[model samples]
Target chain A: MNTQVLSGKPLAALIQQRAQDEARVLENSGRHPVLAVVVATDDESTLWYVRSIERAAERLGIGCRIVDLGSEATEQVLASVLRDLSAEPSVNGIILQTPLPVGVKADSLVGLIAPEKDIDGANPLSLGRLAVGQHAFAPATAQAVVELLDHFDVPVAGRNVTVVGRSAVVGKPLALLLLERDATVTICHSKSGPLERHTQPADVVVVAAGRTGLLKGSHLSPETVVVDVGTNVLPDGSLVGDVDEASVTGVAAGLTPVPGGVGSVTTALLLLHTVEAARQQEPAQLAAAASAARI
Target chain B: MNTQVLSGKPLAALIQQRAQDEARVLENSGRHPVLAVVVATDDESTLWYVRSIERAAERLGIGCRIVDLGSEATEQVLASVLRDLSAEPSVNGIILQTPLPVGVKADSLVGLIAPEKDIDGANPLSLGRLAVGQHAFAPATAQAVVELLDHFDVPVAGRNVTVVGRSAVVGKPLALLLLERDATVTICHSKSGPLERHTQPADVVVVAAGRTGLLKGSHLSPETVVVDVGTNVLPDGSLVGDVDEASVTGVAAGLTPVPGGVGSVTTALLLLHTVEAARQQEPAQLAAAASAARI
Candidate 1:
């Protein structure tokens, strides 16, 4: 059986080019799009991820502000920072990064993010808006999965798509996105009994469980298109997905590689979302800029 | 197979009693819980439903203010009315009745009902908050389904629960509530192909499709528990649910009767939610009232 690799690089590049073009247009209009990433942790991987976002933003000509409050940041401090960022007209998007300090609850702080500036859709308002079929930026990772599926020409409408994990960032949001697309979405979590029961009958299986090798060939049918959204670091300092790549390679009709799949597209989408936010926030500014350019 | 009837009357009575007790206490303390019902249209059924709510509120000693904007109300009028009700210090709960005027979209007006006053959970923010497992009121009908299941001693944890219909008010919200209780929920809609494919294997099936007899005997396994949320009115002025009760009675393990099931509990829950919202909104007011009464 020939296995198809649903790579995210081509899609990510396409999105990145679009973001770059939009960012340049906004910049020419004297309205530079900026993404404010609020980080309260000193975790190595988290810092690495933030740096990658900065590099990506730089490449796209979008301003990336890394508001590192350090490891000892309190929830009060975090909340205040988010509130200020939300009110900051210069900041087009706001992302409260994970792995907060000991007492800082993400749920408590996420609400402080203004919905217009919520590029990653961390705000509950964004989630609710998405669920009710309203226009809101979905979580970048969740939206990336949908974008990847579209890129691969995989039809989600009327298809059985099983989403593994129930995290707010990925699974839950992804399920809402799929449901909007008219897909029969089943969300499986730790409490959900065997993974195979849900995955085997699915037309497309999305693994975002974060546990390495959580999904294998045995869990899916030969016709299943598997999307691995997990990026787990192995003991050998290598990144792998929730799916056991070797086991599901030929058995599954199609599979998305971890590092080169959802992750790449997520970063690209964040930049695009920032650009979009900028455009939405200052449409009059863009119009004025366009008129000035004509003059 | 002899099937058990899951009656919501007992649970509705319990909730009503609780709401009455709370309302009495709140009223004594100078903070009377008031639910404002904003009606826009002359839809007979919608008005009847609103009147029933008013009667229920009266019976519970909770204040029900019917703010009828009449049939010719514009979206602007509806939005302003909702905003005024939301801002009214005496108003603890707000419900915008459906079958609104021709051009008035419920979605646009629902957001105007502040989350604190959104007893019915019509606000997208409320839904979003519920989705993230945050502190928010679940839509009463959705919450009623869970409460009824609990009263009947139906365990949803780690069970296969298929929800038919994907409306924001009932099916979607109910699915989220069930998911929170650790049920592996599958939301089946019109696009989900054949309904039996999703329903027949479920440990529990909740039908909220608004289509009479949407689920029949063949749509379920013998061991399945069914909760009918539909309230379709027949041409003869008879009320029926989405489930064909006669067809499913002997086949399913348990079934909730149409009029005596989710509807009764939903009204009771709405009143309860209003009292609870009142308590939450004016803790200081209640505290002050308690002190005054003590004096």
Candidate 2:
């Protein structure tokens, strides 16, 4: 079977357009959507990701504030910043960029991000709300996988989806999202013995384990649609995903590329979430924005 | 295959003993562990369940407070009561019983329960904390499933576990608990067409769908161990589980009995949680209680 490449560029562009259009309506109603990206580390790759988000926010007509606290930042400092950002009426969304300095735990600080402004769904409250089928923002990366699958017209309801990994950010949340969509989801991790035992039987396989080339052709059936959520930076500075592209290409019916797959769509979704947060935070502005859209 | 009955009586007895011993120590320190059960409905079955809990608490030497708000209780009144209970220093654990009054959503009221006293884990914050592997109480029914399995020496890590339900109270939280134990867990619901498709491949199957005879012998392999979490009341006023015990008995390797299985363990776990909550809430009293235990 010839495998089809599920590129995320088209989906990203479509989402970016939606966000841009919504931002214009909000701006016309005198409400500007602002996203706060809190960075506590000077990691090169992390900085690059943050810059990309800023550029995307600018293009979408959303305000972007980069709060860069140096590597010597303490947990108390991070907590205070998050609390202040959460309370800031001007800030519509907040994203605490990963790769925190030593001794600073992200989990402890994320709870301070109010669920309303938690665009990336970093807050534990957001996750719990998501689990119980309540209104809450799901993590953008995890939502990206679902959005990408929907864009390509892949069915999820009652379909067997095996999410390989159990991280709170991706695997666990992704599973909950899939479950919400009525898809039978199985979560496999490091201790799951052989990957093929879970992957081969799945209608769709989502690899978010962060291990480069962790899944190969032998681990899937020909009918499998694979979504590669892994973005591993190699020694040569090139990026790859958990699924081995070379071997998985012809063996799987569909495969999402590492760079062009879940990553591109994730950034776009973040902007969409920001505009959504802005609209939700200001009910009067949201009404005006809706009227403006109807026009 | 000759099936072995996994009775919860033994585990419940053991846990009750532990709670009793802990309660005795706390009492000696002049601290009494108290559990407040807030009931909004006058449902007969719910009242019966509450009375059973009261009886169990009495046996364990834990104080039980039943706050009956009647069936006409409004959301505001319920919320106010929950908030007051959350603030009460005497109340170590809070349980808001189900079948809440008409027009009263439990989700909205549960959030008012402080996480420190949310022993039943009804609050979304508690559920979120559990998902992220933070310190929080899981719903006793969900936790009982794990404890019962452990008491019977069922190996969960690296095993295939098919949970037949998607409820917040049982299936969802239980899945998280099982995932934390490194089990490759699949959650199946009504949308999942055939029960056998998901349950047959599993080493262990947990049925919590609240449907009588939802899982039959045909849904399992000869080697499968089943945990029935259902407690459905029949028209004859007799209670049965999701599993068809008569049909599943001779086919499965092991099965948890309906009345004697997960249900029994659940009430016992709640008492244990109340005592544990009391110990955590009073630090100085906890230290003294610990010393008393040493004696």
Candidate 3:
């Protein structure tokens, strides 16, 4: 098939080691990186995801705190808790876990996180900065896709990339990131007709549509590079990606597999972002101290 | 040919009248809507644009204040003036004129304006909100394009739209706006190969590339709807658009002319946005007052 499998495990381990090294330096400076994840649901999968994140962060020498706002918590309570965490100097990163309490949308509350502490790029301001080509933390999953391509030395600039999803957290932001890198990006969604028409001509295609088996062999060109961001659970309790890997394995030049791609790298990036947030706060604290001393 | 000229004059007048009506309501409520435009250079064209805005705003019974920072004004001076204007409660809208002095990029300084007071959508936060489909003031020029299309009853939902530029003010934001209306949009720029490859299949094409005569008749399929946003100055000092009007007249079903198309409509929308900002602020101010009474 000549298809190279892009595994996130090796990259995740490499990034985790780097994050651990950085965390040690911050600890030596008497500062510890902490990520506060707010969970507002009782869903098993959501809780499982939270625990995995905690374990991953701890492995990287970063502290992960889970603030479970019980299923009955109102939006106001959640907002207040987020505000308190945002104000705490020890909290380097803040993330609101998904499956938020009923009638309470995450979008309305994510803006409360201090932008610098929004390590996951959940804040609209971060996405906005990315769109305008300014300095801001990109959402980890989107950044992971780019990191995977870069690690493999794939050329992006001046290349055609068709992203087959348009969610703000993934597809839209990813398109902007690619655009900033000087790649010609086309964002297609459910409304975009004839998926093959868009994907066939692209040098690289990113499939983030939640639907499993959305991209078949017919949708890709012989040498197309594919990144599958979908992690759909099959009826048998196993995971299948958006692309039917069996069908496209022979057609595509490079592909990121379902289990060993995107998700693992996303976790590693979150820890790295936590460490990064802690590092950025050092200078700001020093500046504040300097101003106080002058007074 | 059956070429239909989509003049902005009729639309501008209609919107201007609506703006004037709204301005009277705000004035009657003891809150006169005001727009403060900050000019930082002595370029004749820039000054001419400022005067045009001032006259348009006044015609709509909106107060216009020109804050001239002079040609020698530094970035610090420009930022300070914009901050002051933003903080003024009566100044419902704040706009920064183009041709900023050397070393002062507009993007870097526009963030100083408060989002609520940024009627011209200079702030990145507003654009970010728009990206996420949240309520935020869109850039006047971008909104004008959509407003013109809607006024003519050109359906956008499920239509294929090709936007020929990616500037934050026009092309990029317009693409996002069109996306919000359920149109499948492809944003093409200098790097995108063969303009016709993108435009020919699009039900509508919006040309915003500043290059004169960028889109000719050859670029179109029969009966394509074209919106020309270019305002390039010809060698003879006359203004033209990105499209070659003579070449496309016979081939296109609808087209917007250069000098009288987007520019005039953009001016009217700026005033309309000023009124909208004033209207939005009233409720927030009332809430603050009501809370203060309880305190």
Query: TM-score for each prediction?
Result: 0.95, 0.96, 0.94
| Tens digit per residue, CA lDDT, model 2, B1-295 | 8999999999999999999999999999889999999998888999999999999999889999999999999999998898777766778899999898877899888998889889989899889899999999999999999999999999999999999999999999999999999999999999988989999989999999999999999989887999999999999999899999988999888999988999999999999999999988876653543454354
Q: On residues A1-295, what C-alpha lDDT tens digit does candidate 2 reach at each position?
A: 8999999999999999999999999999999999999999989999999999999999899999999998889999999898778766778899999899997899889999988889998899999999888899999999999999999899999999999999889988898999989999999999999999999889999999999989999999897999999999999999999999999989998999989999999999999999999989876654543454354
Measured by lDDT, the strongest candidate is 2
Q: Which ten residues in a row have the lowest lDDT in candidate 3 chain B?
A: B286-295
What candidate 1 gets wrong by more than 4 Å, as runs, is: A283-295, B283-295
Q: Is the docking of candidate 1 incorrect, acceptable, medium or high quality?
A: medium
Under CAPRI classification, how is model 2 graded? medium
lDDT of each residue in B1-295, candidate 3, tens digit only: 7989999999999999999999999999888999999988898877998999999888889999999989889998998888777666668899998888888888778888888888878788888788888888899999999999999988887777888888888877887788788777777888887888878978899999899999999999999999999999887889999998889999999999889998999999989999988999876774553454354
- Over 4 Å off, model 2: A283-295, B283-295
1 against 3, candidate with superior DockQ: 1
In angstroms, the error of model 3 at A149 is 2.0
